[model samples]
Target: MANIFTSSIGKKLIMSISGLFLILFLLVHLLANSAYLFGPEAFDLIIVIMGSPVVVAMVPVLAAGFAVHIAYALILNRMNMKARGAQRYEITHKGEADSWASKNMLILGLIVLGFLVFHLSHFWAKMQLPEFTGGHAENVNDLMHLTFGNPYIFVCYIVWFVALWFHLTHGFWSALQTIGMNNTKWISRLKGLSYIYATIVCGGFIVIAVTAFLRANGYIG
Candidate 1:
């Protein structure tokens, strides 16, 4: 077991599995957030369902999966950097050995992480944490509007989502590649699917942010 974890292939396998776990979580989370499109009542119903005892009990599990994913990524990245011995991040040419997204996963991941902090501050801090601490929970639909109402915050979210798009475009395919799904035919298919999936997944969040921003500014009915 120890040797398996310490081996490069094993570490990568861990990365692939944990990454896929997070991907599944993101899809489910995006679906839940989509309730806002139906209005405050529908969105609040989602919040109620998700906040139920059974779902709340799974929060720790989800957090642990995310933590494991992050830990493995950092460890693998550090090891790769050490092996490259300071040539780790130099992409000086358009035809560099790897795709731009492949070379900059760490930077993209960090940006996403930072934006998550910003996002959680606006929503989780205002809603979940308060409710957990015996304070009133804010309506999630209203929270979306409040968070995106500011043009600056709205722009920030769009930037963050773009970064997330790049991250997932690489990550989705890489995760599959790492797990032995890398035949030539499947390779092309995975790349195409990655873009489609990433766009759909990230697009969902972008639409919400854009809609909220426009609606708050009275740009639509």
Candidate 2:
């Protein structure tokens, strides 16, 4: 088991599995967050359930998965850089077609990670940790209104979502390909599937954030 994780193939396998887990978690999280679009009452109820002991227990698990994913990303990127050495800049594929996101996954992932920290400070710290640490209870709707009410924060979130979309577009298919779904016949199909999946997930998040921002600005009902 230890040797498997230490090997390159094993690390890739771990990353693949962990990536899938995070994707699933994102879908569930997006669903929960989308409830906010229904209004404060519905959203608050969903938050209540999410804050329950069982859900709270899963927080560490989620955090661990995120940590592992980021760690592997850093390790793999450094290895690639070292292996490529001076040729990294000179090497270019002439006849190959690659998506913009495919070429810049690491950069996009870093942007997403940075925004995630900002997001956690604004929402998770105020809501979840407050209860655990005996601080004042955070009202879900109030937090949403306050956070999205700021034009700066709203723009920041929009930028984050854009990076997330790019990251997911490539990461989705790559995860599958890593797990042995890379047959010539299935490659194109998986790429298409990746785009669709990325669009839905990222689109859902962007809609919720933009809707809240619009509502806060009185631009929408």
Query: For model 2, what is the error of residue 126's alpha carbon versus the real structure, in angstroms, after optimal superposition?
Result: 0.3
Pairs with steric clashes in candidate 2: none
lDDT agreement of model 1 with the native? 0.81
Roughly what TM-score does model 1 have, to 2 decimal places?
Answer: 0.91
The segments of candidate 2 whose C-alpha lies over 4 angstroms from its true place after superposition are 85-97
**Model 2 CA RMSD to the hidden true structure, in angstroms:** 3.0
Instruction: Return the TM-score for candidate 2, rounded to 2 decimals.
Output: 0.92
Predicted structure 2: clash tally: 0
Tens digit of per-residue lDDT, candidate 1, span 119-141: 87888787777757999878777
Q: Tens digit of lDDT per residue, candidate 2, span 121-217?
A: 9899999998789998778887877889899999899889889988887777777877888676887887789788888988998899888888887
